[model samples]
Target chain A: MANLTAALTALPAFLMVSLLLLAAVAYLFRDWERTVAIIAGVYTSGLAFWFWRMDLSQPTQMLLGRPIQLVAPLTVGDFTFQVQTLNAPVIALGLAMGAAAFLLAARASQGHTFVPLGLTLLAGYSALFMAAEGPLAPTLLTPLFLIGLSAVSAFILQAGRVGRVAGPLRLLIPPILAFPFILVATWYIDQIALNPQDNQPAQMAALFIAFGYLLLLAPTPLHSAQTSSAETAPPVALTLATLLYQLAVLYMLFRTISAFPFVVQDAPLASWLEWAGLATAVWGGIAAFGAVHAGRLWGYSALHDWGVILMVLATAGARSLPLALFLLGLRTISMFTAAAGLSVLEQQTGGLSAASLRGAASRLPWNSAAFLLGGLGLVGFPLSAGFPGHWAAFQIVAETDWRQAAVVLIASGGAIFSYIRLARILFGPLANRSLLRERPLSAAMAAAILLISVSLALAPQLLDGPVSYILSAFNG
Target chain B: MEQLFAGLDFFATETGVLIIMAVIGLMILTWDWRVALAGLVVVQTGVAAMGVARTGLPAQWAGVQVAVMLIAAAMLAISAVQTPTSRSLRQAGNWPLRTLAVVLIYLAWRTIDVTIPVPGIAPDMAGLFTWLGLAMLLMLGLSDNPLFSVVALLLWFIPAQVAVAGIVPHPSIFALIGGLELLVTLTASYLILVDRLPAAARRPVMTDVVFPDQEPKDWGVTDDAEEVVDALPLPGFVQDMVDSGRAARRSQPPALPAPNSAAPALPLPPGGSENGETISEQTAAKEQG
Candidate 1:
């Protein structure tokens, strides 16, 4: 048991190396089923690792009559990868999400390199969340490196597929643009270390760091990648990539705040985040109304959700942090469920445009229902998985200022209205085309995801464990 | 060789800034991809030279930077060659807008005149960084093509690269930037290549038919070429080609009957004589069909 604990202590490096190796091996296989199976296995192993580590952390759950310590940091030279209390649950959530994506991708047409690139991205994001410091600073150079990896993976997933490269190409922009500000901010930090009394360097560092993270967050104008990719890129792959990347971004933000509170306190970062997030959410809803493409509509709804999450984070208090994290967890579920349905619909309908999907529900009713229900969930409609979290968030925000809450409610109305319109089109009269039959496997997967979404919605307490787990780090 | 090396100092002067500006101008203004690629190579090398002359970065590291830039340029050059439609020599459609953008970039740089004393950089290099940043913005704002956008992204990274080299000069940072530069360039090149390929060529070859006992069948597959192309709307450039193909076929004159050949007339259906078409027309239609 001690040996196992010791091995788990080195889990960061081990997971990174093994996941990368598995990705490479997965690439060699031409069979997508085999490839997806291998990816699922990798994520499953990651989940199992997390479970084991979490079990060990509990004193009551003893191993060999001794309580083993949780996984420790593995440092080599300047690089450090640690499964700290803060990131352990996040890492577990990421792995579980990846596992779920693989399951959904089992019957979806993820591109040829989806498995390999997906696994590689999974490894990169895990490292991003776990990495405390390397070469330059924690979450600065590290996120850029991982973002670079994601851009490449996005390119591979999107390239040679019949679509615009704007989404994948836009992924390249944030890292390149953020690099200088972050690097220079690190320099300023060094200067601050030399002269602690003079707050100028710290101020400059805070402003630069805020700007850099804003770019990384990619709200509003920078959101072209997310919106455009949603319209063009493969649904399942985009969902997994987006959810994982956003999870890392959230973790990075939390860590940066912990390390440098002045960014929020001294600088105008909170206000900026507040306004930007509000704009993003409002724009998302408005855009969703105009989005003729099903995928684009989903993208806008996600942006709206992300905006609300950001608003929650920007609110003044530590409680806002856990609430925001909880909202993100719900977002992961909603997005995955939506993407699952969208993928099958895209495959059966040959496209995601409104014209292509007109009267599609009559043939593939279950998948269509999944798509509609999941999309509605994103808007925080009642009886959806995201309802409880969103309801709590709105109540919290309303406690502070009712106008902000009113604006958010109105924006959510836009998305819900769009979904209602889409539902009409989905359940509209059938055209006189050839019979389009849904595959049994696809229907089964859609049914399963729909069931999970509904079950979670019905029993929101199921999320209590995860919410508390995420909050544990904060409490400590 | 030593004299040539000394002569290279010409790029370290005020004239060097103008020369670099002109190189980027050529990249933005010129329609020929080869010319843009040439400008890309020259600008990257010139930036490295300026870094070495002003910032005091190691000459060997500057050489490494040049090599990496050259490789990126070569990858783009190859992609441009493979995607012939991207290699037009005609003037850009928006050349006037681009020219105005360049002028605005220069004006903005002149107006800003950032004079802050950066820790590891010389005071005079601020103008160069500002111009590069503005030009990069212009390029990114104007470009829709993957090849040009890749060049724009490279421009965006150059100032940062120079700044990092000046500020840190760590071997690890150098390696990291070089590797990322290569990776981004490679990905953009791939995007360019695939963006130009026919839709059928880019379509995924596999499907989600992972059953144990069932024989693989074309379920939900668009097998016909026309159907495949028509299934989903094509991108702008590809759609333009399709439209042109349709137009060319439409404008083609029907083949006149070969001066006096004894060819049999094509048989019409039993109920097809309502229009009263000539036999020669029937034969010509048959040949076209």
Candidate 2:
């Protein structure tokens, strides 16, 4: 058991090797979708359990009054991977989402490409979260992430049959533009590290880093690629591109901010983030309300959720940090479930427009239910997965400024209206009745996902232990 | 090495090379494939000259720059040639727009200060780097053609690489940058090829239809027959003759041929004889008969 713990301590190395192995296996067994799915499922779930065990060790140590380290840091060639309190939950949520996405792909029969791409994305996110804070780390990891992202985009373009050069160009250009800023930030941060007294460059570097993240995250004005992707890309590919990629970039941004605390203390810089976040949220909600396409609606809702998360981070208060992390976790689960359900619905209907989906509930009841549940959760409705995190964020904001809270409420209300409108369209009179029948495996899997969301909503206490540990790290 | 560079100071100075680079960059903005390829080679020469001046490396190092440029240029030329001629060449006759873009790019570059300076690089060289980078970005924004965009992207990397070389000066980093540049160039070539393939040969890319059930019709048209005839691009005389012939045939009733009779042959047009007779000769022959 002790040896097992020691071996697992080299999590980064293991994860990278596992990524290569899974990709090879997937390629070699491309003809057998079931085998690839099983391999991906075991790997992702194993990583998630490993994170859970690491998170559990702190409580066990405190209760037993002994220094019990379940996971230790591994260092190799100036790179280190330590299971910190903050990243454990983040990594766990990401792996869990990967697991669910892979399972959905398998059940839905979304082709052999999903397993390899999903594993590659999982590895990228894990490495991103595990990257230590230093000049070399950001500089090295930024390019690595861009290369991985480019590969994923290429695959998605190939699988989705997206013939337009614009889609792939849009995906590739932003990272290229963002890379220079990250490199500049790295140089400045290194300068600061060398001479601790130079604080000006640190602040400047933070702003640059924030800008790079904004480009990666695709806030309101820069969000066309994501929406186009959602419309054209396959469900599994869309999930990887938008939900998984967004979460990884957000965590990377968080790590950057945590490394340089002074950047948050800069008043004008933080205020800019606040304003940008607010504007993006309001705009995204309005755009979502006006969207007739189901995929665009999902894209806008994701944008709105990210806007709120950014606002929470912009507050730069210790209290808001944990709330941000909590909301991120909840949003991931809900978004994955929602996106998976949409993918299934799209496959069954051959389209996702309101007209095509009219009265779809009578045909794909499980998918419709999952979509509705996921949408409602994103809107922060009661008994939905996003309720606790969003409610907490509201309370925290209201104590400081009522106006920001009001804006948040309006965005939530707009999202709720959009979801309700979608529900009406989905359950209304049958538009083009067909003989298509839902697959039992996919239906059951989607229902299980919905059940998980409902359970998370009904009992938010399930996240208490992890959230507390994350918060404790911030305090220390 | 310094003495050698001094001997060629007319074109090797920072300001002199920048002027040459700017000219090549503007030529690229014209979006002509042949001209752009030539301009890119010039741009690479400028880069190598500036690199030698800044780093004081031996003249042999310039071979690396020329080699990379030749490889990249070869790839671009192949992609351009394979592309249909109708799509490959475009003329940017809108001089005002081009002029405005250049002015704006220059101003933007001028306004930006290189806060982190490389020890050996002068202020003018840094400014030139900024100018080159912005110009590439402008070119990328203005063009939608994959080949042109790829060229612009490749150009954008050179300025950044040159600037970083002055700062880092490490061979491994240079090697890494070189490899990355090669990868990007190859990838861009692949994208161009994929873009040019026939729709059926390409992978399926699903597009959402705006109106699925509506039958396509010409709006505000009452006479469908006349509209179809009017849409044909034949000469007026030819169309008139065709219409008259069709009407005459449709109006006449078919006569039944006798059981043992051969079908009557129709007369050919004046110049339509099998033996290549001229219209004038046929007319004279008819008159003689």
Candidate 3:
């Protein structure tokens, strides 16, 4: 009974991953992978809330009273970084996203045979994150790395040969172009390890890496592709990948920042980041205005969200970073969920452009609601998880430069307006017309979307705790 | 050792007025005006990118002055052309003449700072650029003409990215400019041609329901309070012709079934077949679905 009470109390922190892993393994071959994934997300999200509320550590210090030391690579060349895994929140998110993706696939009527692999992927990421010491080894990292690799490979394998995406070669180039830069950069970094040095060069390198990913994302006209290739992905798979790229990469980069405060402290670098965020935000907004496609609109909105976060982080003091981490975690999860839900809507038309959505709402009411609320939540619309982070960020800005913050809002208007446009298309007046009506969304898909929105609205605090944990861990 | 490909490197100082002249001459002699125009835009953008991006420019302004002179030479070639080119290729007045105008404008605006409010902070350099870009996008994105919008998008996006990364002392992102421009231009073409599909209304002449004899009583409009012929899924030109033909019913109005509010019709429908009534009824019902 005492154990049961402790488990119930701990539901927000660990139950989500454990339960999800159990269900994923149990139903790895079941037809309800879609439904199962959603259940997992709910538990995982609850875990984030529990962490946020209790923040159990006291006299919180890095290493929790142990002297922190950077593990020196036995040799600068061919050094191995390793640790046993233990983080609860990150594992929970990874599982939640993985499950949510599986659920999305299931919602689309695919078999859930892939659930076990996804669960393993979650476990791998968890083990890396949850360790008493946060250092990771290349060997231990292999499994999680395989998640990204296998996700892409599995999709191609499932596609099985008849590649009909031949409409525009120009449309296909951006995503292809992007991979090489990231792959090359990651390869180069793995080749060499520097002394735990100052932050400036590291910041510069991280900025380049982030830009490499952004190039692949191709938010606006600047991209070489005519079509957003991301539209071809499984909603869940794409969501999981995006969460990994946008927030995970960001967290990794932030962790590295502590080793180089001088970079962040450099006024020129700080000003540059502010400028970059502003540009990204405004550019995203403009693109949103011209966004005639649902996926593109959401994609641009995500960019804007990234910009907002970047701006805040750029301006924030070290003490303020916990808030930024909190927001990033909340949005990464929320956006992944929303993007997954949008996948269902995309299927009815076999596409996801703004025009494709003509009369889409009648078939997938709940899914559309999920896309809408999720987009709003990601953008920090009034009461969503985004709002609190944005509000706090603004307060921080107001102390320094209220005028600039006002401008940031104006630039962010692109996200706000585009989301409104998406809503209008999905649930507007009965003026929408269609010729071949799309099939209605599956119950699992609809349920998953609703759950994501509700979770985001109900308990963003769940996210706050894990973020603090990560920060505390990094504080060493 | 003799350096073979040293000239090819961007850092090589051998690049000068001769190179600029050669490029301008190539634009005039071998290239199409559109290519020339794009080239000109590229050159100016490259210069701006150099100043704004961390890429160091030629150590001396002498090269820049020479480059401008060559640009003037290219403009002269464009103005001298007999054939008009694609608007995108209008480099004649754009480079020499337009460049002059921009210079004058800059001279005037340099004295004044145009700042705008943004979210949560003061207008830093990147913030200022963003405001400018947004304003440009609003003007261009909302334009009725597709081509104009594309041009505006270019104007807005490039400067915006440059401004954002510029203020940082160690700015480094060239692929962003090249790659993004390619994507934006191509996507616009796709949207216009593929996504914004034009609905075709193909029908033979006899399908027109208008009477051939007298001015037709009630103009084929029934007690249903809807014009029978108006209900056909036809483009304006075809619908006009069908209305004029005033022909007999064709194929029993193509056997339209009772309206399912959840299902919307395809692109074209036969005339009559209870079209308007079915649409409004279906739409009203669709809301509840």
Candidate 4:
């Protein structure tokens, strides 16, 4: 038991090494889909089982009877990795989505790059979550994360259609620009930590950190790269990169912002976040509403959801934090389902433009259902998983300011209208009756994903326990 | 000899190096490719010299810095060689905008007060740091070409590193920054190569340039190409229309063609080859006639 606990301390390293090995194997045996699937299945299931045990067990009793500490920090040189209350659920969710993506890719003959790149992304996220706990995390891990993202972008570009350079190049910019800001912030924070009297640099550092994160999130004005990629890149790659990577960045942002209470409590920064979030939400919704490309609609919708989450965080109240985290989790599920479904539809229809998707529902009913259902969930429809989280966030924000509530409602309305527009395009008349049907296995996977989303939506309580655990950790 | 040594040391000072860097940045903004490339090398050498003098690091570290700079320069040179002649010759902008930016930036830099004290750096040096940082940002903001943007990004890190060197003076950080410079340059080179590929092999341009109608004159079609297009044979009614279109075009010129004029050719349906070949023959015949 002690040995197991000790092994757990090196878990990030283990995961990274294993994923890299698996990537090598997958690359070498690109033709062996079953082998890749088996490797991915084993890794994801192991991660799920580990997360389950970590979540269910007491911190002291997590590793058998050895009285192991789940939140024990593992230091390797200058960096630290730990499975804490805040990140356990996030890690679990990331792994689950990764596993789902791997399976979907395997079924769709995209296992070669998807499994390797997806696993690498998961490993990067794991390290990012762990590293984000400390102030120096950005200095040490930001480059590593960016490099990993660059690799994924490169892989996607290579696999995608010719002349599709813009998407990957766009993905590269935020990280490249972010590196220096984070470095400067790290230096400032270190100075402040060393000399408590120095508060002047703290403000500048905080602003840099916020701007760096904003770039990382790629919210509206800076969102072209993500939107371009979403419109052009393969659906599976888009799902993995956008959902998992963005979630990690969000989590990191929360950690960094929370580290500097001075920054969080400052009225100007908080207000800035609020206004930015609202603007991003409204802008994204309107953009999504007008998007001609179905893939880009998914991107814009995801952007809108991120804005909502950001607004919730901007409230900076304890109650809103959990709600924001919950919404983020919901977003992960909805985006994966939406992107996966869109990928399948894109495969069958050869494009995801509004014209291409017109009447697609008649041809690919299950995929269309997944896409619409996912979009509805994302928009916080009554029965969707997003409803409870968004509702709680609105209630919290509304208590403080009604105008913010009005903005939220308007944004949500725009999103709903956009989703409806997409639904109309998807469910219009039968344009191509002779369309090839999706394989039963692929359809089954899509159905299973849709089922999970619907179930989570219908029973939002499923997230309550995890959310509470995370909140308790934050409070502690 | 002592006076000469003292003067050389003066150029290596924080203020002197920053001034030199600013001048190089200006050169980058206004100069042609060959001169700009030379300016970049000078900028790097000045930066390395500052690192040595400011940090009191061993002179070998300066050599390492110069080596990294050479590698970066080599990458830019390769990319410039590979880039199409038109794009390679593409200026950052006209002299007027460049001059306005320079004057504005210089005035702003000279007047602005920097309150946040970067540890170990003198107040004047800190101001220089802030100025160079803003200058790098301006360079990035003004340029759309990937090559110039990457160069701006590479230069952006130097001022910060110089400011920090006097404070922390860590070897690893410098090494990391050096590695990052190399990584960024390599990535930029890759993007240039990718950008220069035949349109059929490249990704679709994703930029939604607002004033596409305001494209630069260098990108304008040559009169010879227009004459060639006008000479292309057309059916009787189409020929009459083409003549009218030519007259209209002469009055109000067309916007620059898409970045890759060859893109439209690649997507022709497989069965349309005969029709395409026949049209090509007719155009050829018309030109010969």
What's the C-alpha lDDT at position B204 in model 1?
20
- Candidate 2 chain A, poorest ten consecutive residues by summed lDDT: A59-68
Tell me the native contact fraction for each prediction.
Answer: 0.42, 0.06, 0.00, 0.08
Worst 10 residues of 3 chain A by lDDT: A68-77
What lDDT score is found at residue A467 in candidate 4? 68
lDDT of each residue in B1-289, candidate 1, tens digit only: 2233245667788898789878887777653466667787788778777877777767777778878888999998888767534332111234455566678777766787654345677666766676667777776665445777778778867777888877776788888888888888888888877765532211222221112112222212111222122223443554566567556654777555577876545433332333554445654565578
For each candidate, what's the DockQ?
Answer: 0.34, 0.13, 0.02, 0.16
Cα RMSD for predicted model 2: 11.8
DockQ value for model 2: 0.13
| Error at A78, model 2, angstroms | 6.6
Poorly placed runs, candidate 1 (over 4 Å): A1-9, A38-77, A473-476, B1-7, B88-93, B112-118, B199-289
Candidate 2 residue lDDT tens string, A1-476: 98655554455656666786887778788778767887787778877877766654553232134343434565644456656666776777778777777766775655567777677777766766766642255533465366446646555544535234544545656665565555556566667778888777777777766666666666666665665566656666666666666666666655666666655564255676677777777777787778777877887777777778777877756677778878877887778778778888887787888877888887888888887787667767788898888788778767768798788788778877888898999888877677376778778888898988988998988877866755554443
lDDT tens string, model 4, A312-410? Answer: 877855677778778877887888788768878988887887777888887788888888777767767787767777777778778878887777677
Model 3 lDDT tens row, A313-364: 6684764567667777767666755665576776666667666676677766
Per-candidate Cα lDDT values, in order, are 0.72, 0.64, 0.45, 0.64
Best by TM-score: 1
Q: Please name the candidate that would achieve the greatest DockQ relative to the true structure.
A: 1
Report lDDT (Cα) of residue A132, candidate 3. Answer: 30
